[model samples]
Target: MKHYYFFLVFLLFTSCQHFEKQVPSEKELLQKELKAINWKEVDEYPSFKDCDKLGNKTQRQQCFFEYLAQLIQEKLSIDTLSILYPELDTIEVKVTIFPNAKMKFEPQFPKDSVAYDTIKIDSILNARLVDFPKVNPAIKRGIPVKTQFILPVIIKVE
Candidate 1:
């Protein structure tokens, strides 16, 4: 009877199941991670001079825009431009700052019919950059990146 009990116990133990672990491949893991990231947004906005002192992201961004605008305003002879061409009192300029600190400026005038010295405006904007400190480029996924900003400049006769 004891021998029979021992044989039954051995059979039960042998019948128990075991499973092999399933592991994901490197490609599969990478694809999943890439899809989870926010491609449309940067991890951090570009930093300009004093903007780095701001603690919050929103405030930093605001300070960057303000500082850049102020710098441009100081450098730009808007009054002269307006005086030369009264029609160009307000303009919307799109500025693209590359990771290398290179810039491209595109001005959107009030209307298609307006004509002005665009080259001079562009040159003025470029020259003003000298006063502005070297910028810390935007970051996406820990990599430095470039960004674009649309700034509006309004000149009043007052």
Candidate 2:
């Protein structure tokens, strides 16, 4: 009887796999880690000099736009060119800043020959770049990122 009871207890313990813990695989753990991060959003927005003083994100964004507008307007004024032609079309400039704060500019103007020379525009932009202060690039996951901005240099016909 004692031998039979010992055998029965041993069998019961070995046959029951319900208490066994299944270890998770590395792939499963990696999937869970990826899911925890929100890929749609950035950790922080890009900053320009004097714009970072604002405490709120909304204000900071507004300041950034204002700063860029002022900087471009100050650099490329049509006051001298407007006198030559009674009317002039607006110029659209796209500036992209890399993570290292290096700038690349793309100026879009009328394809046809106009009063303003593209070469002069290039020289003006290049000259301003030499004096431009380094901007703080956007941040993602504690890493610096590239940012692009479009600035419209609007000149009134009047």
Winner by TM-score? 1
Model 1 spans > 4 angstroms off: 1-21, 117-131, 156-158
* Candidate RMSDs in order: 4.2, 5.0
Model 1: weakest 10-residue lDDT segment is 123-132
72 Cα displacement, candidate 1 (Å):
1.1
- Give one digit per residue, the lDDT tens place, for model 1 in 51-105: 8888999999889888777666655554366567676666677878888876666
Q: List the residue pairs that clash in candidate 1.
A: none
Model 2 scores a TM of: 0.64
104-139, model 2: which lDDT tens digit per residue?
777777688576677876666666535666678778
TM-score of each: 0.72, 0.64
Model 1 collision count: 0
Compared with the true structure, all predictions reach lDDT values of 0.74, 0.72
- For candidate 1, report its TM-score: 0.72
